[model samples]
Target: MSLSFDVFWSFRSPYSYLVTKRLVRLVEEWDVTAVIRPVRPLAVRTPDHFVRMDPLWRPYLFLDTKRTADYLGLPFARPRPDPIIQDPQTNVIAAEQPYIQNLTHLGIAACRMGRGLAYIDHVGSMLWDGTVVGWDQGDHLARAAAAAGLDHDRLQAMVDDDRDGCEAELQANEAALRAAGHWGVPTFVFEGEPFFGQDHLDVLLWRLRRHGTARRSSGEAVDG
Candidate 1:
């Protein structure tokens, strides 16, 4: 049996985007399963999250994310409209947020179709790679879905067909994240051990190896 781990991720997190590529690589190379568990971003989970942050947090986040993206050779840019809508002056989260809600549901739908990691990686690149201005407009998500071998219309239809079910799954994922002892994105939980942050990916890999996770043998086909 393949070892399995849960990847707790949020669409609004730049660090989540930063770690996805390597997570994809890890699945391809290891004898393990990555269960992508999409959760509402902190802004949604805790309406007062940003409001309570230190004044310097936002500035440092921008500076650090850009440099980290550059270091990783990944294209970087602020999401054009931002995923979570909030008042810039007051950090008050908007009551109506369509972007993240749609993305979260779509993520759950893709996971149900067994392409969660691929879906996030392709779609995330579109949103954060500075490639498109209005990523939510037109057929952008559809094209990204195609890249991940998913039918875009079908994916959306799944979410539309069972919005409540998807929301329930998301809530369960959030509960699982907390149960795993962390509430952060890009957290890789192996055997219930929570490894938070992209910077700790190497440590996670080391731990995986120590627990006997092995490289895929040549000629063994890897699948999502």
Candidate 2:
């Protein structure tokens, strides 16, 4: 038997970025498989949520994320273009529309191709690392996808066109995530247990190891 975990990820999430780096290492070290399930960020699916964010939330996020970045020694900066790509004057988010659609769809596509982890790391880094000013541009996303060894052109074309096949798959992922009892990014689920946030990864790992040992000792096949 092989151990497997499902990761509920969101590209618009800075916390997801932090989790990705650690998750990559965990899967390799533990010899386990990670099932990446990408979903649209809360801002897109529920704009009202964004509007309700407290003013202090932004500063709090910066402080917390900085501490996490320092601890992990990973590059950290506020996203340049920000996930909410909109015109200040008109309050229009044309530039952002494609990203919400594409990021969500790309996860499903990568899963289909068995390259879900790669896709998440590459694209998620670009969105969270704050290296680029505007990630909404097709070129930026394409380049990131290329870095992940995926066919940039094909992925871009699919995302740009909102191909029904991909969109439908993403919707399913979102539904599954919601049914899993979490609406946040970087949620890890094992045996129906939900752990939300990067801060909980260690706890999750402990659970996995404990469960693995118990199963093995009970004469059950050990998962990797």
Candidate 3:
């Protein structure tokens, strides 16, 4: 049997967006499966995740995330309208959020259809690539969904009707992530070990290699 890892991901995390560029490669180039477990970003989950964060943290994150995107040659833009509605001055989050809930639910539905990883790569690019003015609007998500081989209509239908189950799944994911010894998105948990951050993908690859995790056949295309 092949090895699999749990990806604790959040749509609101730039790191989650940044990491998937290589993550897509990881799955394609190696022998492994990534199970996507979408979690509510802390802004939506606790409302204070960013508010209570260090004063210098948010600014540095913005600077770092954009530059990192450039470093990786990935397209990126600050989310227009932002995922969670918040007061920039006070970091006070609002209660009536429309975007994140819909996105997270569809993400869960994608996982159910076994296309979660692809959906994230495609859809996350739309959300973070700064190419689309409103990533959630019009044909943006639809195109992303199609690129990932998901039926957005059906996914939304499932999300609309299965609120309780989706929340339960997200809650379970959060609990499992905490149990794995981290409370961060973009965490890859393999064989009960938690590898956190975009920087950890290489280390995770090292561990996978050392442990005899499967490799692609010769000349199979690392980026394929």
Candidate 4:
């Protein structure tokens, strides 16, 4: 049987966006399966997470993520209309979060269809590639869904019809992440070992290779 790893991810995390393409490459290159588990962002999972974070943390994260993106040769930008609705000055989270809720639910639906990685790769690029403004507007998400081989209208309908079910799944994903010994997005867990950041990806790859992860047959083109 092929090895599988659990990916705990969030739509609001730039780190999650940054790690996705490489992850796509990993799944394509190795005979492994990614068990994509979409989780709510730290801000949502623990409302006080950002509130209690060190004052310098946000700025450092901004600087580091951009530098990391440059190092990886991927376009980077702070998402416009940042996914989490919070006061930049106060770091106070909002009560109603329509954007994140929608995106997370769609992520759940995509994962159900076995295209979760592709969905995130496409949608994450849209939000973090410094190219789009007002990412939630018009048919932006629909186009992204299409690019990931999903039907946006259908996914939306599924979410609309079973919002509670989706929330339950997200909660389960959050619990699994915590159980895996980490609270961060883009965490990849293999055999109960948690790799908690984009920087840890090389370590995760090393571990996977050590476990004898096989290469895909040459000429097998990777999917987007």
TM-scores of all models? Answer: 0.96, 0.83, 0.93, 0.95
For model 4, residues 112-189, the per-residue Cα lDDT tens digits are: 877888898899899999888999888889999999999999999989999999999999999999999999888999
Q: Residue 13 of model 3: what lDDT?
A: 91
- lDDT score of residue 90 within candidate 3: 90
Between prediction 1 and prediction 4, the one with superior lDDT is 1
Tens-digit lDDT string for candidate 3 (60-142) = 98899989999999888877768778898998888887788788888998988878988888888888888888776788888
Evaluate model 1: give its TM-score.
0.96
Candidate 1 per-residue C-alpha lDDT over 1-224 given as tens digits, one digit per residue, 9 for 90 to 100: 46888899888899999998988888788887888899989889989989999999999999999999999999999788799899998899999889999999999999999889889999999889998898888999999999998999999999999999999999999999999999888899999899999999889888888889899875342434
Ranking by TM-score: 1, 4, 3, 2
Of the candidates shown, which would achieve the greatest lDDT relative to the real structure? 1
Q: Between 1 and 3, whose lDDT is larger?
A: 1
* Candidate 1 global lDDT: 0.90
- What ordering of candidates by lDDT runs from best to worst? 1, 4, 3, 2
User: Residue 96 in candidate 2 has what lDDT?
Assistant: 51
* Model 2 error, position 133 (Å): 3.1
Regarding lDDT, does 3 or 4 come out ahead? 4
On TM-score, the stronger of 2 and 4 is 4
